[model samples]
Target: MTLNRRIFMIQSLLGTVSLTVGDQAHTEIPVLFEDDSQARNLGYKEDSRKVDTAKFPKYSAGQKCAECQWFKALPEGSTGTCGVFSGKRVNRNGWCKSFVHKE
Candidate 1:
């Protein structure tokens, strides 16, 4: 076999293994800190009930990240990714101004 062919086959195998292993060992998303700039801007609170009612009058007692359209619900944790904050995670019970009800 050519040297280039061997290299390609090895790379493909490594890529496949990486993906498989990654899927089996999914890491929990870290909880978003309320102090985070974006969180602050969105008035995100770890507990939706704690959201500043004065600042965000639209927020209701029942609003939650787990039910928000922007939230990417994690399979096994109380934290998940939000479309508004790409790299950071938000608590499933958290609330933010940008929340939209999931259809």
Candidate 2:
């Protein structure tokens, strides 16, 4: 095995591995709040404070999707999948009428 040949093989393997990891990391970003009709009807916001308190009296301060019962998974980002959103990403600090207390 020549030195150059060994290095080339190692580099090829690394490149393939990196590509696979990158693709897996971002398969398909779930729909955003404004893109989904259900979220829109419920007054979903990326920031809970942006919710119209006058129209949605149920929304209170400090209520976020991450803390809601409907939230399925909240990775380390501001976006997350919720039961109500159905393949859409809701805000960690977002609020909607569907928000429920997490038991």
**Best candidate (score: lDDT):** 1
Over 4 Å off, model 2: 1-27
Q: TM-scores of the models, in the given order?
A: 0.74, 0.68
Candidate 1 residues 1-103, lDDT tens each?
5669889999999999999887654364456799988788878899998887888999988999999999987766777889988877788999989989999
Give the lowest summed-lDDT range of ten residues in model 2: 26-35
Evaluate all candidate structures by whole-model CA lDDT and list the values in order.
Answer: 0.84, 0.78
Model 1 misplacement above 4 A: 1-16, 24-30
Distance from true location, Cα of 5 in model 2, Å = 26
User: Model 2 residue 31 lDDT?
Assistant: 56
lDDT of 2 by residue, 23-102 (tens): 66634756575647777788888888788889999988888888998886655575677788776667777788988989
User: Clashes in candidate 2: how many?
Assistant: 0
Which pairs in model 2 have colliding backbones? none
